[model samples]
Target chain A: MHALQQKIREEGIVLSEQVLKVDAFLNHQIDPQLMHAIGAEFARRFEGTGVTKIVTLEASGIAPAVMTGLIMGVPVIFARKHASLTLTEHLLVAEVYSFTKQHNSMVAISPRHLGADDHVLIIDDFLANGRAAQALISIIQQAGATLAGLGIVIEKSFQAGRAELDAQGYRVESLARVSSLASGRVTFLD
Target chain B: MHALQQKIREEGIVLSEQVLKVDAFLNHQIDPQLMHAIGAEFARRFEGTGVTKIVTLEASGIAPAVMTGLIMGVPVIFARKHASLTLTEHLLVAEVYSFTKQHNSMVAISPRHLGADDHVLIIDDFLANGRAAQALISIIQQAGATLAGLGIVIEKSFQAGRAELDAQGYRVESLARVSSLASGRVTFLD
Candidate 1:
């Protein structure tokens, strides 16, 4: 967690008061050692939670989720942002709005991968408005699966995402929490 | 490699003569242990090749690429399939056509992540018509980076992907090669 926070401070670019770009290491270009550490940390945090599956959105979420799944010895399921030709029928779909992109995309998962017997842990790269997280939670609910917990690499604490999830009674753990990205600088939450 | 072949035989679904759906492990719902094995195999195959970085497309390619990067002690960069708001200016872009989806998408990467001194190893989930591989190769070329090799998790040998890359004089290593999927049966290329 310290390493991640340090990396964000070192390489994260603050585009605006609301945008932080971690293209140098976290998302576009990744540091595998840091990813492994984050995964280990998540696995440790949820060690006794009996997590049967790790769910995440595609693209950025795959690395951390896969690493967590590897350490936790569970399967990782990534919801597709776009509808695929192969991914049709028995699908659990949820519409998610991306504040950054300013649009809504339907995220879907095959129900065959998730079931009522599964305990699912959600992992992702960034948490901002919590729209994506809510969409994943919706899909998990549709499958009648139990929510183990949510693991996020970076959270924009200035936003209401964490508060909403907390209010909803979901346990969310984030490795690096950015309190502010004011004046082209990053401030971490204590 | 044997384990991968066995997994394909057991869980891989052949939708048609050309399409093999490996959603059970390699993509949508991933088996983390199998992915680790794949990364180890790729690392073993590309050992001591002076690979400074691992490159792949987003979504499916992230897991294996990150695992290989972890073992090989290098950075992993995934080209974004769609244009990102933060990813603007000084971009190396290539247009790639997806055979299964019947669409063309422009893939882009930041020039800050890749450089002339870097040696890149391209990794991907599947190799079919070779368009994606070609696009990645173009990006590497644009950056003046050296191509170490190409590592593919599954190669449809019946298609022109392998032949095209081979013709282009790129060294390609595929963990599992399928010779045919006729009559809904997967035949490995021995």
Candidate 2:
């Protein structure tokens, strides 16, 4: 967590009050060494929850989720944003709204992959509005699976995402939580 | 590689005369254990290549690319399918024709992430028509970066993908090459 926090301080760029660009190491251009450390940290945090599967959304979350899955020795099921021709009809689908994209999209997983007996750990790169995490949680619930917890790399604590998830009775753990972006500086939550 | 071959034999579904679906482990529902092994195999194959970075397209390719990046201890840069508002204006863009989606989509990478001095290894899940791989290669070339090599998890030998890459003088390595998928039977290329 300290390493991630240090990386955030060194490489992270704040474009605006709401935008934190970590493309250099977090999302677009990933730092595998840092990701491996982050994955190990998640595995350590959720050491004994019987996490059978790791769930995440497509695009950005895939990198960290794959690393976490590799460390946890669990299969990672990424919910596809677009249903391709190869995807079957029987699937657990959930609609999510992206605050960044400003649109609604559906994330889906084949029903055959998930079952009632599985325990899932939801992982994502950032938890801004918590829409993506909620959508994944919805899919897990629909599959009759138990939610182990949510692991996030960077979280915007100023946003209502944490409170919303807490209100829903879900445990959320974040490596770095940004409390404020005042005067073009990032302040971490204590 | 034998483990992956066996996984394909057991869990892979032969969709048609030409299409083999490994969604149970590769695409839709990923087996992290197998992916880690596959990642290790890729790392072993590309070891000492001075691979500075692992580049891949969005969606399915992200997982294997990340795994390879983790094993090789390099950064992984994934081209974005859609340009969100968060993306920077300076980018290396390429047009990729998706046969499955029946459309041409533009993939972009921030110019800040890739440079002329970088050695890039392209990784992907499947190699069929090879349009996506070509698009990625073009992007890397446009950035003036060195193309380390192309690594693929599954390659359909019946398709023209390998031939096209070979024509372009690329050292393409596929973990499993399928000669045919006729009547729900998979035959590997020797």
Candidate 3:
């Protein structure tokens, strides 16, 4: 966690009061060691939580989720942003609005992958407005699976993502919490 | 590699003469241990190739790429299929046509992540038409980076992807090679 926070402070670019770019090590390009550390940290944090499956959104979340899945000895299911020829049956679907990209996309997972007996842990790269997390949660619910918790790499604490999830009685664990991105700088939460 | 071949034969769904869906493990829901084995296999095959970085496309490729990157102790760079707010400067771009999705998407990577001194190993989930590999190769060339080889999880030998890359004199290592997918059955190339 310290390493991630350090990496964010060293390489994270603050575009504005609301935007932080971590494309150097995360987002676009990934630091494998950092991801491994993140996976271990998530495994350590969520230890003994009965996590049967790891769920995430496609692209950015795959690396961390797979790493966590590897350490936790669980299968990882990534929700597809677009419809694929291979994925066209028994889908649990949800609509996600990306505040960053400013577009709404459908996120779906096949019900065949998830079931009522599974305890699903949702993992992702960034938690800003929590729209993506909410979408994954909805899909998990649709499958009649139990929610283990939500794990995040970097969280924008200034956003309503954490607060909303907390109000819903869902446990949210973020490795790096950014308190603010004011004046082209990153401020971590304690 | 035998394990991978076994998984394909058991869980892989042969949709048609051209399409074989491994969404049960490789595409949609990922088996972490199998990916670990794959990453180790790729690392073993591409060992001593001076692979400074692992390059892959987003969504499906991230799991294997990150695992290989972890074992090889290098950075992993994933090209973005869509434009992002955080990624907008000095990008090396290429257009990739997805035969499966029936669409063209621009794949871009930041110049900051790749350089002339880097030896990039391209990794992907599937090597069907090889358009995605070609796009990544183009992006790597634009950065003046050296390519180590292509590491594919599954390669359709019946397709032109392997032949084209072979004709180009590029090294390719696929864990599992499929000879055909006829009559709803997957036949592997020995």
Candidate 4:
């Protein structure tokens, strides 16, 4: 977590109070070693929680989620952001509004991937508005799966994402939680 | 590779005369153990090639690319299909036509990720028309990087993808190369 916070302080580009881009290492272009560490940390934090699977959204969330699943030796089911020819019709669907892309898109998971017996640990890159996390939780709920916990690489605690998820009684662990971001500077939560 | 072929044989759904969906294991609902085997296979195939980085496209390609990067001890960079606020303006861009999505979208990679000195190994889930590979190749070419090789999980050899890359004189490998798919059955090339 210190490594991630250090990287954020060094290479994280804070475009505005609302937007912080870690594209250099986190999302678009990834540092696999850092991802491995994050994954291991997630595994350590969520150890012995009966995590049957790790779930995430497409694109950015896939790397950390994949690494987590690899470390935990579990299958990773990343809900598709867009409907493809391969994805079937019988899916648990949820609408996600992306502040970054400035649009609402559907996130879907196959019913076959999750069920009442599965305990899913949701993993993702950034937790800002918590919209993506909420969407994945909804998909899990629709599948009648248990929410084991949520793991995030970076959380904007200044936003209400963590607060809302806390009120929802979900156990969430964010490796690096940013208390505030302003003027191209970031402050991490203790 | 045999394990992957076996999974395809058992779980892969042949949807039509041409479309074979392995979303059960390869793309959508991912099997981490299978991906580890795949990453090892790709490493073995491209060993001692001085692959500084592994390149892939967003969404589906991230899992395999991440695994390969983890095994090869290199960074992984995936091109973005849709531009988000995080992606910078200075990017290496190429147009990719998705047959599954039935549309054309622009793929862009950060200039910060790729450079003249880097040797990149491209990985993906499927290679049918080779449009995705070609697009990634163009992005790598734009960055003046060396192409270490290409690794794909599945390839429709009956299609022109492998042929075009072969004509281009690049080393390419698909773990499971399908000879044909018809009447809900698949034939693989030796």
Least accurate stretch of 10 residues (summed lDDT) in model 2 chain B? B28-37
Question: Which ranges of candidate 1 are over 4 A from the true structure?
Answer: none
Model 2 Cα lDDT, one tens digit per residue, B58-86? 87888888888888988899999989978
| Residue range A116-182, candidate 3, lDDT tens digits | 9999999999999999999999999999999989999999999999999999999999999999999
Model 1 Cα lDDT, one tens digit per residue, A1-190 = 8999899988999999999999998779999989999999999999999999999999899999999999999999999998777776679999999998889999999998999999999999999999999999999999999999899999999998999999999999999999999899999997
The C-alpha stretches of model 2 lying farther than 4 A from their native spots are: none
Tens digit of lDDT per residue, candidate 4, span B1-190? 7888889999998998779988888788888778878988999999999999999998888888888988899989999987777775898999998887789999999888899999999999999999999999999999999998899999999999999999999999899999989778889997
Please provide the root mean square deviation of candidate 3 (C-alpha atoms, Å). Answer: 0.8
Q: Which lDDT value does model 4 have at B84?
A: 78
lDDT of 1 at A71: 98
Alpha-carbon lDDT, every model? 0.94, 0.88, 0.93, 0.90
Please give the distance, in angstroms, between residue A52's alpha carbon in candidate 1 and its true position after superposition. Answer: 0.3
The best candidate by DockQ is 3
**What stretches of model 3 exceed 4 Å from their correct place?**
none
| DockQ-based ranking | 3, 1, 4, 2
Q: Taking chain A by itself, what TM-score does each prediction score? A: 0.98, 0.97, 0.99, 0.98
Of candidates 3 and 1, the better by DockQ: 3
Which candidate would rank higher by lDDT, 1 or 2? Answer: 1
Model 1, residue pairs in steric clash: none
